[model samples]
Target: MTLFTDIGALVASAIGGMQADGILPGGLDLGPVTVEPPRDAGHGDMATNAAMVLAKPAGKKPRDIAEALAPRLAADPRVASAEVAGPGFINLRLETSVWQEVPRAVIAAGTGYGRSTMGGGRKVNVEYVSANPTGPLHVGHTRGAVFGDALASLLDFAGWDVTREYYINDGGAQVDVLARSVYLRYLEAHGQEVEFADGTYPGEYLIAVGEALKAEVGDAYMGKPEAEWLEAVRSFATDAMMELIREDLKLLGVRMDHFFSEKSLYGTGRIESAIDTLKSKDLIYRGTLEPPKGKTPEDWEPREQTLFRSTAHGDDVDRPIMKSDGAWTYFAPDIAYHWDKVSRGYDALIDVFGADHGGYVKRMKAAVSALSDGRVPLDIKLCQLVKLYKDGEPFKMSKRAGTFVTLRDVVDEVGPDVTRFVMLTRKNDAPLDFDFGKVLEQSKENPVFYVQYAHARVHSVLRKARDAGLDVSDTALAGADVAQLDHEAELAVAKKLAEWPRLVEIAAKGHEPHRVAFFLYDLASDFHALWNRGNDQPELRFLQEDQPATSAAKIALARAVSVVISAGLGILGVAPVEEMR
Candidate 1:
């Protein structure tokens, strides 16, 4: 159990006693009440805002409630002192024994230490990296992939039944461009020179696809008309591109539970069914949208079209779902796809989109709301761009991707663990400057290296203790007499360890896996601080010669830090290194 939550329960129990004794009114809402660490360490170990939140409702002064509650809380053996601080907050200093139990609890739980049941096993589908079936995934798509995968793992750790999904955008005109590009490569394989036009892809990656097509059908469509070979080439090209995308994802340690094809929704009545579901609710209609607010486009023209009344569900205005030519608009398939997700019985839906798709957020949310009838919640996270640098200069572009840096380029330079960890060092919506030179440095400035170094140091401590004939296994450490870990520096690390469960629940609830990375960094900082302090104080060291019991106690604390670091790294899809090279 989490120490914060356990202390919160104790605070609630004390308030309940106050209500029983008629010191305060009954039936007060304690939802806003929280027990967390005090802002100032000298104030107390933990602080609660129960009195401040209850003052208005109970019609009693905050100090009156806090003064009455303090005695009841101080009565518990676990509480060393329960002092009323400031106006109403009750600051509690728990017994040192309470903090010592953190290491023991961590040792007992192992990698599962911070896992929670906060989700209650609700279903959530996280769709990310739905880049078009173009060549390889670029750095922009890489950020979305890492964010979405980490979010899914975070939700799973918080006890949600999560499905990791990728929406293949193969139904658009881009795939047709891809097909034409591959046809050029196919023609080149037949020894006929072909020049790539403005609209077709000219990336070097398409060369292999062209040769493969030539291998499959020798010169069959060599001089055929566009219509005669367009469909065949499109199918073949998209499959090949999707295979390339899958390989890129696999290299980054990302695996999708499902890949929903946009092409599958077309001609399968899925789009019609989804629109019909909305039409039944009067969300579909015939209309013409007003000119957009900014400078009117040169092609701007008012034309009657099939529109979705997205404003009814909080969109800025109605959106077109079908063109006058009876062809489905780009929005139609997206609406249908989200409707498909809603129809799958998910309690929640999350889309991880690149920053360029920021404009689609409100409309997509409106579509899901109208389709799900507001039963399911939808959250769309936008991942900003990643700018690569090497030696403090802008990194070069990938020759294979032609226009941008590919995911493979980054992962190949720095391993997947480094790529994933460094990608999450910033918030999803913030621009990240990935410096190839800095991330590999073995210094505190590099978060990935610093955090991994802490873990490695713990193993070093364990190894030294083992060589000294000390039993430092997790089983032995769990039963260690941790009362010897009474130093303030040692207990400081234990306090940080106690924050793990609460931090996990908070990060999962907020759909911010970056918070996990930040927390791990802070935890590593605390661990490193203790390790550095040990250098000056012999008794503060983890492996105390001629004192096996004290060494076990200190090593148990070190092992707990490693456990938490490993668990946090796992959530970020990073492998913890035992020794840094």
Candidate 2:
């Protein structure tokens, strides 16, 4: 159902025939072949590199091979033409009937038309939005969350057994700060004046946790020693913060498959085991790191520490795993967590980190590489910042979050569908300006509404066709006189529809879900262009006055476009609108 491969396989078939006929060398492998849309559509519908890609290996001239292969490809009933262009690139023009059938395929397939089995059912662990569980998720975490969730969905569509995971920083000093902050709030609940110190969190979101603590243990620890209250308060505050964060994520339509606690990595000997494994490989060593390059930090001092030789696996320098005082560094738990992922037998590990954490990427990759013996590849995707704008003005932070804008603030103002779609309209690593007014705009400038409107229009056509007493259901539409869909405009939309399966494969392979958003925009443009042409060309219209045969054929093309838009929106976690409201 992925048209890209079907077309590529056809091209492969042609080259294969040439090989069999001795025009191409016998046993000349064509595995490196590729059939993709030409960078410039002026070249053709699709451009294949089979001849050129196979030339050097087969010891044959690329143009000679293309000339011999072109005829066999053109002979296929679905191919309208196959001409060798500059240097042996075979540009293929598919038959008009081939495009007319795409809509029927989409109507029959629903959102599953572009789904691929490219991953071969391999397990992939996508760990994202592991924001510290000390406070509510902010705008930065929102971008990371949407990017991760959409990427996971894209991989799932491409046949990865993907697990969307979150790592809780419940083991850090920050949680202790959460404990102290909540304790201060607890005293306030008991009517005692307390102050939020310099290092303590001052966010108002903890107010509810204070009230909850008062409800759970009213005045029980009002005058108790720090020892008697810290443990219980720490656990209570972490749970509350996690609950708040979960709600924030839910507002944006994000749900994690796993909420891994850093506390679990402690007291379990797992960290020791991971370090021991690295030590066994001589990757763990006790040494003094040289002062960082360019300028030394003020705290820089020469001292022996347990260092991980990460540079051996591609890091800039060896990293510290344990402090001189014998306490494990924050990186220790990370190593253990990835070792756990490796033990779970995942074929790949992908961590979606905020851009601020760009410094940690190499060490994390080294750890996973060592733990998995380089068998499991790790790809770390860093999501840049999202600057929220409202009416050409930068959005202000919530006083409640104290210097930050909360994710819920964004999601509450814009629906989850709009929030998710707009966030993904840009690449994950690229900084995105999310304008509240622009995203809500009804015109083509608003990609979310534009794509959704395309789907809604298709539904409108279906409603019209249904009342006309035509069998416009998928089964009936698939049997329409598809040959009537011969117009260049109609065929252009169908060609875009055919690219869906291939787009999914490429996007999933790169762990870039933004490609889906971009592809949807292009497909919608094609659909809209055709719809506009119908204003001047009545025969190109989706509906034919009292002519069911012609109507079904044209409607099939429109339905196919909608099917793709819906599928793309589904991958982005955006719900398609049945009608523009």
Candidate 3:
């Protein structure tokens, strides 16, 4: 259960008691009141700002409000003491038994202990790793894939109906370039030498696609004109590249619920329908935009074009939907894609874009806002670059990807678990340095290993307790005399366990799955600290020689730590280890 939320409710009830006793206004606003852990643990177990936030609204002094509310809170059986601190903040000391029960509750719930209902089953569409289907996925795309997948898992754990989606960029000039490149490979498969032109892909990864095309068509299109084979070849190359991308994602444990094709928006009346909806709202117009910032008017060319009044919805300027050549701009299909998502009635939409696309943020949000009439909210999370390091030096490019390191290369150097966990060890907006040399180390500096070691430690304790003739099953541990876990160090680990549900809600609300990685690191640190403390205090050890009940009680606490670690790692898409090798 959420201990902090329960305590916050008690604080609200105390405020009500004050109002009922005529010490404060009857209808004072208590919405801003909060109960949380004190900034300094030495102060108390928990703290509340109920007095200060209500002082001005209640027309009473801060200290006076706190004085009136303290006794009401202290009267609860769960609250051992409630004392007013500096400037009317109330610090609460909960009963020892309350903290002692946290581990037992964790054992009772197992890995599901931290699951939250904050989302209320609302639907969310998370679109990420929408790299163009022109080649294999690179390291940059790997970061986005891991971040988006972890976020979807975190939202799912927090009770949201999450759809993992990838928008395929298959409608633009890039796909045409891919078709020509694959044609060259097909010629090479036919024992004909070919040269890759300036605008064509030259990666060796397409050799198999070329050979497969040779097998399928048997050189029928070898001498055909561009119009006779462009469409079919484009379809073949796009499908093959997408197959490669799917395999790359599978290597990293990322699976999309849907693959939306940009090409489908064309020739299906969908693009026109979305633009027509905007036109009916009077948002479309033929206008010439002003010269861009830092550009002289002479350097800018103005033309009457189909534009969307994006400025009305918080964008910096209006955006053109169609070019002077009577063809759609790159933004036109993107707008239609998001429009399709909004029309599907998702409660919210989240796009995981690369940091280079930062300029498109406001305009895309404006499109969704205008299309949905502000009914759905769009959040765009941009992932910054990932710099890879190995052997104490920066890792260079991969020949397979031609210009950059591919996702498969990183996953092969270190397995998918290390690749995914290290990708999320930093904020999405912050640059992450992924060092192959450091991630696999057994030292505490590596968060992945640190968390896994903690989980393994608990399993180790369970095995030892079982060998000592103590019942260490979850049911047995959950039913043990948990009251024996009264030491300060033991209770500290339990207190950390109590924060799991709150941490889940916090991470889910911000759509930041990296926070889950950070929380697991902290939880592991606390568990490790307690494990070290058992060395000096023989009675503090999880296993006692003859006291089966006492050993079970302590093993319960250790097992609870493992349970939370597994749940946190599960959200991060990292499989928890049962034992360290």
Q: Each prediction's Cα lDDT score?
A: 0.93, 0.88, 0.92
Off by over 4 Å in 1: 295-301
Instruction: Pull out the clashing pairs in model 3.
Output: none
In TM-score terms, candidate 3 sits at 0.98
Who is ahead in lDDT, 2 or 3?
3
TM-score per candidate: 0.97, 0.97, 0.98
Could you tally the backbone clashes for each prediction? 0, 0, 0
State the local distance difference test value for candidate 1: 0.93
What value does the lDDT take at residue 264 in candidate 2? 97
* Tens-place lDDT digits, model 3, residues 465-579: 7777777888888898989999988999999999889889889999999999999999999999888988988989988888888888889999999999999999889999988
- Model 3 clash tally? 0
Query: Poorest 10 consecutive residues of model 1 by lDDT?
Result: 395-404
Q: For candidate 2, lDDT tens digit of each residue in 542-564?
A: 88998889999998888888778
Q: Can you tell me which runs of candidate 3 are displaced by over 4 Å?
A: 26-29
RMSD of 3: 1.3
